[model samples]
Target: MRVDVEYLEYLWPMRHYLITCGDFKGTANIIAVSFCMPVSKEPPMVACAIGKSAYSCGLIEQNGEFVVNVPPKELKRQIYYCGFHSGRFVNKFQESGLTAQTARSVKAPIIQECTAFLECQVTQAIDTGDKRLFIGTVLEAYADEDVHKGERIIEYAAGDFPRQVYGGRFA
Candidate 1:
C-alpha cells in the first residue's frame, strides 16, 4: 500500500554512481548519485540529476564536464560518506580517502578505486525544480578487466541484463 510521504524515492534501490565534477585547477568535487541513466546510444549520452545548489552542480555547470564512476560494493562506506558530506566544507577525496586520477577526455578526475568510469562533456542542461539534470555524451569509458572479465561497461546497461543483475536496497 503506497502511502503519501513528503519526500520519497521512487527508485530506492537504483544503481548508485559517483560523479566527479570540475577541473583539477578549479573546484573539484565528488558526490554520490542514484538518478543517473543512459539516454541515448547514437551520440552516446547519459543523464544525471544533481541538486541545484550542490558544489558539484556549479562545477558541472561551469566546466561542462564530469566523470561518472562505477564503484564496486567494497567502497560502499566511502560512497555513504560522499552522499552525506558537502564538498563545500570538505575535500571529499581527502576526507573519504578516495583517490582521484586523470580521465582521458575530461578535466574531471575519476575515482581510482572505482571499477569503471565514464568521461563526459555536457551537451544539455535541464532545470527540474530544485535539481538540474545534465546530459552528457560519453566521450571515453574504462572498465577493470580483472573485475568485469573483459565485459564492456556499456553492455551492462544494454537491455534486460541490468534489471536481471542489479537492484537491492541496503536493508
Candidate 2:
C-alpha cells in the first residue's frame, strides 16, 4: 500500500494530559496532548512530547515531577479542553471542573477523575525537533476502586483513533 506522506502525517492526533506539581506553589496544572508509552515494563517508563512553547513543558523541566492521568472515554470533552488551552493563561482544573490531589511520591498532582494515574519522576529530557521528549520513570500507580474489578477499562484515543477497552488483572 502506498502511503501518502502528507496524508499519513494527518492520520493521527495523540491526546493525553500531563499534570505537574509546581515548586513555588502547591497548585497542580495540566497540559493535554498526545503522548506515548514507548516502553512497556523496562524500568517502567513513558514519554511525552511537549512543544517548546508550551507552559507545562517548562514546569516539567523545572520540577522534574509529573503525573500521567489517564481518563476514561467519558471525559473526552475535558481532555479536548485541556489539549487546546494554555495552563499559564487559565486554571485548567477550574475551567474543566476537575478536582486534584497531591501525589504520594512526586510533587505533581493527580486528576481524581481519571480511572488510573501514574506518578512519574523525570529521568531525562531531550529536545526532538520542535518538541521536547519528557521521559519519566513511573514511581507509583493506582486504579479507581469502582472500576478495579472490571473486565476492561475504556479509554479515548487522539485523532482518528478509536476508543479502547483494556483488561486488567487484580492482585
Best-fitting candidate, measured by lDDT?
1
Query: Ten consecutive residues with minimal summed lDDT in candidate 1?
Result: 156-165
lDDT by residue for model 2 over 5-57, one digit each (tens)?
Answer: 44323445555554554542445687765655655587899888788888888
Question: What's the lDDT for residue 171 in model 1?
Answer: 18
Q: Top TM-score: which candidate number? A: 1
Candidate 1 global Cα RMSD: 6.2
Quote the positional error of residue 51 for candidate 1 in Å. Answer: 0.3
RMSD of each: 6.2, 8.0
Query: What does candidate 1's lDDT look like per residue over 1-171, in tens digits?
Result: 875632324444467688999876557789888789999998889999999988899999999999999877667778778888889999999999999888888888888988888999999999998799999999997788866775443322112112322224321
The reply for model 2, stretches above 4 Å from the true place, is 1-3, 7-27, 151-171
What's the TM-score of every candidate structure? 0.83, 0.80
